[model samples]
Target: MRQLSELDASFLYLESANAPMHIGSIYLFDASERETPLAFSTFVSYLRSRLHVVPVFRQRLKEIPLRMGHPYWIDDPDFSIERHLAYVSLGENSREASLMTLASKILEEPLKRDRPLWHITFVDGFQLGGDKEGNPGFALIVKLHHAAIDAFSGAEIMGKLLEYTPKPQPISAPRPWQPRPKPSEERVMLQAGANILRTPWRVTSIAAGAVEATARGLIQKQLRRIPLSFPLFTAPHSPFNRQITANRQIVSAKLDLSRLKAIKATLGDVTLNDVVLGLCAETLRRYLGDQNASNDESLVAMTPLSVRSSTLNRTTGNQMSAMLLDLATNEQNPAKRIRRIHWNAVASEPYREAIAADRLTELLPSAMLALSARLYSELQIAQRYQPVFNLPITNIPGPQVPLYLQGARLVQQYNAAPLFDSMGLVIVAVSYQGSLTLNFTMCPDVVAKGNSLRNHAYASLDAIEQAASMLDPEDMHTPLEETRSQSMADSAMNLLEGSLKKLTSRLRR
Candidate 1:
């Protein structure tokens, strides 16, 4: 039995009825070239053949006796592919909007723990979106628990499941498979006992390492004077920073990846990620301005960074860290906004080592970590503290080459990350086959105007594109004030004041 790590197990403990911890992707495939339609039986057969590739599919969580240790992943003797697969018919209304709505509804519920922490829904009646109306296509919605894999790991698994070439040879049926016998209870106790005994020394060692790394990081920061914004002290509370509900709405817009790359090239020192941030910043600026809730301080985004080493062969669980990034929404000039984002990201690279997820997860026991998270939600702690880096902004890199499953060419792919208390919005942008699709995953309870965000993304991209086209690289950083206290204090005092005012208004009511 393969036991879950402390980090992976926390995802299980942290899960609530409303706040489900799962990540999902929608893969729309174009099978118009096929002589015959892809049959459900054929697809299921193909999936069954590939089950051995991702071993987690045949395993389910086996809890320790009386929660003495993290859950163990054991082969489910009765595991059936049918339990994890479903087919949904979209009927005549196969527009992109309808697909997104259906996805939102499906994602609103948590996955059953009795089975493997993943589900694949086959969606029929999908029209080829964007002017190609009558051309029929099908889609697959895959949901995997965050405990099973993070975004990077998910991408790796996706690559393994699909084919690289369009004309690959067909996969033949395999011989009957056998699962390893369930481990004896005595062995389970022994494994858990080993982990328990190691926890004290391991935790001490982890603490010492964290302190040393933090000291080194602070010294580097002081010597260079990188005015980078840290978490609690700087992030401002936005409208979306309140508690969220299970009611979710997702919106997506596809963009030409080449245009973003060209912008990155034109901007010289800027990266494609910087360009993406600029577009998101402008999107928020427009949405907030329309709602008459614009902030003088720029919003901060907690950006997740994958920390996987090339030598490591495993592509599962959460091997990631995060940095709090300034979106620079307060900057009106599109060129200046992007450049600031680039500079800030470049400046903050050194600090990544201090806050790596591996180090942070070791600071607390798995059970304690889970309990703390639950208390933070139940006690409404977010309302009292400065919002911890507004919301999550994750960028998942995808294969530039085309991918195929069962001879159907994958066209557009969109993804959504799970939401939690005080984090209503999660911006998940993924790229596939020369196109980048930006998806907004929002809880309608906290962000009432969630739909408006995507519509504004187009305008946001246009504005940034125009600015990059017209301006020279040297002219991008024409800032009124040169320095930012990591760009937080220059105008961020306004946010602290704004948060106070909001709090006061709430008290009055």
Candidate 2:
């Protein structure tokens, strides 16, 4: 049996009814490409044939006696592909909004612990609504527990499951399945006891490493004379950091990837990620402005970073870190916000705290890690702290080439990441083919205005696109566009300043 790493196991302990720890993606397939319409049975057969490609699909978690340790993955003797796959019909309504709502409903509950932590729901009879009305297409809703894979690993697994060619290639014959016998409770208990004994030295090593890294970070910060970004708990309380509930609402919008690339090209020194964050900043700015909330303070976003090496690309489990960066939502200029975000991301990489946290996870025993997480959850420590970050912004790079399931051509793909304690919003951006899809998962209890946020996301994209179009390569504005663009910027800044002044006055009183 292979034991779960602390980072993987923490997802288990962090899970509660109010916060389900799983992330998933939705894949839309255009069935018109196929000579015959793609059926659910055909998709199931495809998944079954490729089941051996990813071992995690057949493995189930086994707990130690008395919960003394983290769970282990063992091949399930009774594993059935049918158990993990199901079919859902959209019925009368097959609009994109309806599909998102159905997807949210499907993911409302936590995955069953008794089975493999991944489930697939094949949605049939969805209308793409092209030149032909009721042109039947289909969608595949894939949900995988966080313990099984991070976004990077999950993307790799997706590539493994799909094909580069529409013509189905014959899969290799599977080797005979030999199930390993389950370990006895006494053996597991004894093993847990031994692991507990070694915890101190392991923890000591981790602490030393963290201290060294932190010291290096501090020295780097001092030499650069750049103040560290806003610390956790410093983020002003917003609707995003309230008590969360299980009820969730999900929505998505797509941005032209070429336009994003053009923005990066036009803004010479900016990266695609910088452009993405700039859009998110504007989205939050508009969203907060609508709520009559203050945008004077910058909001912090916990951005996930991939730690996987090229050699370990095929390996599963979590090998990720996170960085906290100020979103600069208060900045009214789109161009300036993008540049600042780029610089902040570059400066903050050297001081990433998530690496130290990951190191601690690597050294600490599972039981100890789980215990600490349990305490943090049960005691509601998040409420006491201001908030480590306002929300999580994750960007997963997907295949630029088209992926196919049997003969159906994959069209649009969107993804949603699970929300953690007090984190009401998680923005997952995934680029497929030439489109970047922004999927938002919000806890209804905290972010009651989910639909509004979704609309603002699209609006922000439009604003950024407009801003990028107006700027010349030299950052000089043509006489014709300069006046109009400047007017727009000035108008926004005036309103923002007025709002900030009022907020300051209210706080002073």
Candidate 3:
């Protein structure tokens, strides 16, 4: 059995009642042709067949005999698809409110580890008002432990589960279940003996690595320590950042990627990610300004960076480091902020040294590695010594083409990420098809009027779009047709006032 990766273990350990530490997606599907009884059985049978091939699908933790091993399907296990999937009907309410309520329910408690590593809730019977052309749709919420898959691999797994064609022939035959023999007491003792044999060399290597890390930390103390002193604009202590209850609120916005792409084209090679961050920064700025709690200090965001190689794409667990970015909200111009963000991201360096140190520790004996990890986590050297960012931003890329689930055409998608105690706000962006849907999950107490954040986000995008359009020197002088008319009206009033003053002077003479 393969051991749990360090990234996966970290997620498992960091989980608490307030934060479940699971990544989930909400997919809206247009109504499709109904499946026959035989077809439905075929679908379930296909899933069962797939599960046999994928070891992770059926595996539950074997914590007692073995600490953690590759998941093996539980034989004759209790499997209830109905319990995992739920159907709800809202009474005379907006879809957004219904979705928010559903999100709150999902985050109410962490998943039980006695069963599978993941669960899905297929929500049908949604009654959203729309034009005749718009068809009725249902939502599928898929929640999986972070240890089970990274964002990229998760998308791949989703692709595998869906079909490209409208209707396909069903596969025949379920594989016979054959449980592998559990390791005996003697085998366990033999494993322990092997670990003991390697302990000395492992200790020596770890000690040397620690020395090197210490030296590097000393040399780069200034850069590493800056995050600590960086003042947070919304540093107002709120219940959100304090100990949290087992409740969560999720809000999402479907943004047009084509608009973002248009802006990027005008701005010259700026990434869609930069545009997203810029919008978030502007939104925060406006929200704080509205509350009269605006600060001149730059807002910082913690962006997770994936460290996995192409070869490790299917590997589960978190292989992530963070980069603290200055949102530059103090700047009034949106274009300047976008440019600054792009440059800052480009200039930032990856934590290669720290990753190397982590890799070195992995080479040590299991016991020693576990001990070192525990010490590091308990100390929280990264959080304490490093500057505390205001929020966490995650970007998960999804399938470019339309995806279908159970014959329904998948439309919109939203991602829900965890919010740490210190970082009250977590912004997640998932690109599905041609749209970049942004989801914000935050502490309600800290961010009062969370819905307003969506409005500000739209305004920020508008500002950026306007700025990008003004890239042409001629366009800049013309003041844009939308603004030009307003400016002319104001100028005309000023000219009339000057003429009136002269006429009054002549009359007085």
Ranking by lDDT: 1, 2, 3
lDDT of 3 by residue, 400-479 (tens): 88776556667777777765545557888888789887898876755678888888888878888887776664533332
Please identify model 3 stretches exceeding 4 Å from their true place.
32-46, 52-54, 64-96, 128-134, 168-177, 184-193, 196-242, 312-315, 351-387, 471-509
Quick one: best TM-score, which candidate? Answer: 1
Error of 2 at 62 (Å): 1.6
Lowest lDDT 10-residue stretch of candidate 2: 478-487
Clashing pairs in 1: 227-486, 484-487
Q: What is the lDDT of candidate 1?
A: 0.76
Q: After superposition, how far is residue 326 of candidate 3 from its true place, in Å?
A: 2.4
| lDDT for each residue of candidate 1 in 378-447, tens digit (9 for 90 to 100) | 6455655666678788888888989987777898888989988888889998988788888998898888
C-alpha positional error of residue 145 in candidate 3 after TM-score superposition, expressed in Å: 0.5
Per-residue alpha-carbon lDDT of model 2 for 339-419, expressed as tens digits? 777766664433333333354355444544555555555544456556666888998888899998777778888787888
Q: RMSD per prediction, one decimal?
A: 9.4, 11.0, 16.6
Error of 2 at 238 (Å): 1.5
Largest lDDT belongs to which candidate?
1
Higher-ranked by lDDT: 1 or 2: 1
* Clashing residue pairs in candidate 2 (N, C-alpha, C atoms within 3 angstroms): 233-387
Per-candidate clash tally: 2, 1, 4
